[model samples]
Target: MTCTIFYTTAMPNDRAQVSGTAPRKPMRWAVEYLIKTPDGRTLVESTKTIQRATFEELRAIMDHIIGAIGDEAGNIASFVSWRATARGGRSKRRARR
Candidate 1:
């Protein structure tokens, strides 16, 4: 199994900016992870928007996710989408077992 992670910054629209306030950092950051089989079929996709934060912190989180996927590559099909977990989908123990 192979996994790819994609992420980008989301800028706020003019309406979100205050006339007098300093420009806000990006409205949020969008992150996505795509889990695929060796042949290139997408098995699962997860996306999330996180509030602005320090680069180190964000990088740490991204590293953690990538590490996790690598650790679980052998059983990738049993992995659940991160988005689904946020929405109260199957728990990790149940998903794997």
Candidate 2:
């Protein structure tokens, strides 16, 4: 299986401005996920937007992606991510295992 991820920053109050006593919050992150089989068969392709994604929410998404891929040869089970710098460039140092 092959997986690709892309993330972007969300606009402030892009959806709406509601009148309420509670604080107003807008989604801050949007992530796009694509999963495909080795044979080029698409499994899952979706985008998730959240105001603040909790650990459990992220974990569940990972579990779902993994379950869809299944455990098979030539599948990627581990992933690493690098934080971009303020200039929109990758970190100076690479991620270490």
Q: What TM-score, to 2 decimals, does candidate 2 have?
A: 0.29
Clash pairs (backbone) in predicted model 1: none
Give residue 25's error in model 2 in angstroms: 11
Compared with the true structure, model 1 gives a TM-score of 0.36
Candidate 1, 30-61: lDDT as tens digits: 46565554545564544566665333355566
Top-lDDT structure, candidate number: 1
After aligning candidate 1 to the native by TM-score, how far in Å is the CA of 14 from where it should be? 34
Give residue 54's lDDT in candidate 2 (0 to 100). Answer: 39
Which ten contiguous residues of candidate 1 have the minimum total lDDT?
14-23
Report residue 39 deviation for candidate 2 (angstroms). 1.7
lDDT of 2: 0.36
Q: Residue 35's C-alpha lDDT in candidate 2?
A: 50
Model 2: per-residue Cα lDDT over 1-97, one tens digit each: 1112222223253222222122122212344444554466554433444345332244355455455555642565333121111112133587889
